[model samples]
Target: MLTALKLTAFGVVDESTLELGPGLTALTGETGAGKTMIVSGLGHLLGARADAGIVRRGAPRAVVEGRWEVGDGIAGRVREFGGDVDDGELVTLRQVSAQGRSRAVVGGAGVPVSTLADLVGEFATIHGQSGQIRLSNPDRQRELLDEHARPAELARYRADFAERRAAAHELAELESEAMARAREADMLRFGLDEIAAVDPLPGEDDALAAEQAKLMDLDELRELAAAAHEALSGNENDYDAMGVVGLTGTARKSMTRLSDRDEAAAPLTARATELAMLAADLAADVAGYIDDLVADPLRLEAVSGRRAALATLTRKYGATVDEVLAWAASGAARLAELDGSDSRIFELRDRIAGLDSSLAADAAAISAARHRAAGELAAAVKTELAALAMPHAELRFDVSDAQLGPHGADRIELLFSANPGSEPAPLGKVASGGELSRVRLALEVVLATGGEGHTFVFDEVDAGVGGAVGLEIGRRLQRLAEKSQVIVVTHLAQVAAFADAHFVVAKASDGQVTTSGVRSLTHDERAAELARMMGGESDSDSGLSHARDLLARAGRG
Candidate 1:
């Protein structure tokens, strides 16, 4: 519930402090009497966008502040906004500078405008003549019906719907994955075929290259080996002294003859003979080795073909036979896994189908709940309308299936039939401004009794209404005050007649400077004001008497 409101240099208001109570409080003045400015002030306090031009002329800034008795969710939200609040004593202040910068404060701490907006939103909702006209939007109409429904059933329906949506999303991604892997499966098969045909053994390509080199230069290699062997071993040459063993024998005999006088010649001769014998043995082995070096083209061609196949595999997979084999092993394993994935996907799809079917049932159940709630809502609104003097008007909630949204599967629209047999259209289409005001009044009446918000304020709900209809609007507003706080800004005397509290806004100036201020009008004062609204001059006997009579009839005893 709101405790107080203060405005300074805001719109047409120069300085005003309105002390409000728990019941319905009404504001009434003539057109251009700044009644709308009071609504704008409340909006500003609730974190609406501000323009510096709204400040009174020659004023530096516009200010609007409000104090609330936090109830229900408001206290929690106030603390969330960094205000330590107990029992809903929250002070929200907003100031807009002429330079276009605006500031907001909660509990004396400067805070962001959004913070204040969030806190105030928990306490009240401002349904303006333009934005967020409660009955004008289809979605809000649906939400109202849902709020009035069975809470446990709505919760179950919401949970089922969420599961259905999650399953649907998962099914979509799984199907996409299957398609992507199909391409991969083909590529893997192709690679495996190309590699399997090669049948490469590790290091086989290098071994083949060495074997081919040996076969290609077989004759040249054999010739070089034979020459080297011949140089090392020769049987015919230098056996004794130079030609063979005979020459070495002659040298040894000579050396032996000299050995009688000097022994060095005999040792030299024996060593020379041993070296000549080794050369002859090597020459014989060389002749044998040359015979084995003959070329075999058939074996050579086989080696070349084997090497080519290994090389192909190396180029396709990796630089070596081992790498190609590793790639084949991995690709085969993954392809097996991918093939098995299709079964799992099918299982998920089946499960998702089951959930989807269940979700529709759950949604239908929720829709059924709404239908029951809508009937109750219609009855309640009709009761409110009777109190509002539109006894013939019938309000109905048309509950039907709409597009699946975050909320649920049902769409509820508020329909009205002002007369019999006329097809009931939506609330916005059939109701006039005066009728709309009363309709809004009836809605507030219902929501108030339900204990929705801490405070409810109606601006210009008397737009096109007067007389008994206007008085009934006032009476209903006053009745709503019994539950929660209510505020109304109007020009209708009948509405003004039922105010638990009355405020009058008048433009006053001392020549050069002009300003607007508000004060609560007393009972005698209210009569004069009501009479003035009853089409009589202020202070006239007829006007004063009528104002008194109107209050008396409203049963303000």
Candidate 2:
């Protein structure tokens, strides 16, 4: 429920604050006195498009703010957006600058203007001349019928329709790309076969390169080994020159002779013996290495050829053998998917066929529900019209079969007739602007019977209506307000008489500036305003008497 609204520098309003409450509140004033500005201010609070022209001429910006009693539905959404809902109320603020820029704040947190729609749209509905115009659209007619008739059935049908659409989309994609996928599959298979031929192992490339270098210089390697062995241990032809092993043996014998003469020389003799043993072991290892060296051109040729094969794979697939193997593994998995395209396409088609069957069943259920509801709704609205002074008028709902759509397979139209024994025609053809307004009101009253709580704003719903019909409209609005808040902008005294609260918009002007303000009316002030609305001087005795009687008739005396 909207608790309060404040507007500053907006439209003709310099600054105005309205404290609203539950039940019907009527806004009445003379023409051009700026009653519509209240409606415009509420529109801004509801995230309607902002216009710089709406700012007061001398003001830099216009601001509109509203306070609402926060319900669970909206409070949860506020928390989702990191906003605070302190004290069970939510504050929404909108500002429009002269440069056409707009800003919105909700629950004391800045947010995009569009967020207001999600937070506030469900709780309030604004009906104006444009709303009446929308009533003529065929799609809008169908939507209203669905909303009234079979909301649950319609929801189920839409869900099934979405599933069917997704299945169809997948099937179309698979069929369109059949040839391209087949080509891709073949390329992956060819790469996998090439890698399998060499079957390279991890680290094999570097190991083979090292072996190849050694084989290429086999003769030089053997000659170097033989020279080193001869140096470590003298050959039989060079026995006259002592080798490292013979030199160390002579040093050990001299140290031992000295140690026999003096006990301290024994430590030196032990060191000489250790050096002689190490030299002998080194000579034996060199001799073995010389014997192991052998030139084999067959093994060299085989190693070189294997290295060439590995190089070819590295150049084509990866920088190294390990990387090449990784590519092959991933390619094999992808090939499996591409190769199974035919099976996947078949699966999608089967799913689509099943969804199509379910969708048809759901649509049939929705249509049946709509047909039953249409008859009942038409009867109820026709009854409402009778109280509004159209006793002979009839309302009919025409439900016919249509091709499957997201909504359902039913096409709904509202038909009307204003005279007895006349054939009912489409609403646009049979109803005048006044009849249209009454019809819309009748429908809203009927549909809103058990709906969630909302704040309904009716801007001139009594247009082209007066007399007892205006009283009936006012009565109905009062009744509607029992379940929700109602704010109506009207000029008819009969309508304004039923208001639980009344506000009058008055204009003030100096030589160079004009401004408008809104104020709640006292009991006597309301009576005077009603008199002015009745086309008489506010202080006229006869006008006040009539106003008093009207208020009494509306049960407001």
lDDT of 1 at 281: 61
Instruction: Supply every candidate's count of residue pairs whose N, Cα or C atoms clash at under 3 angstroms.
Output: 18, 0
Candidate 2 lDDT, tens digit per residue, 1-557? Answer: 89999999998899999999999999998899899999888888778898999999979999999899978778888988878887889998999999999999989888999898667887887887787888988888887787778556677778878888887888899899999998998888888888899899999999988888887877898788777766666666877877778888899999989999999989999999999899899988878876766777898899889888888888988999999998889899899888787899888888888877887888888888888889889899999999999988898889999999998887888899999999999998879988998999898888877654689898999998899999999999999989899999998999999999999999998977778999999999989999999998899999999998999999998
What TM value does model 1 have?
0.65
Q: Where does candidate 2 stray beyond 4 Å?
A: 8-14, 31-33, 49-63, 70-87, 94-115, 223-293, 340-343, 507-515
Best-fitting candidate, scored by lDDT: 2
- How far off is residue 431 in model 1, in Å? 3.0
lDDT tens digits by residue: candidate 1, 1-557: 78889998888788899898787788887768788888888888778887888878888898988888776456665566576665558788999998868999887778898888877766676655763266679877877777677545566656766776786786677687887889999999999998887777777777888889999999889879865754554334545324333444455667657766777676765676565565456555776778778789999999998888887878888788888899999999989988977876787778777866766677777778888888887898898888777778898898777875556677778888887787888888888877777777677677657664467878877777777787777777777778777888878888887888898888777897767788899888888888887889979988887788888878752
The alpha-carbon RMSD values of the candidates against the true structure, listed in the order shown, are 10.8, 4.2
TM-scores for every candidate against the unseen true structure: 0.65, 0.84
Candidate 2 residue 522 C-alpha distance from true site, Å: 0.9
Candidate 2's displacement at residue 368, Å, is 1.0
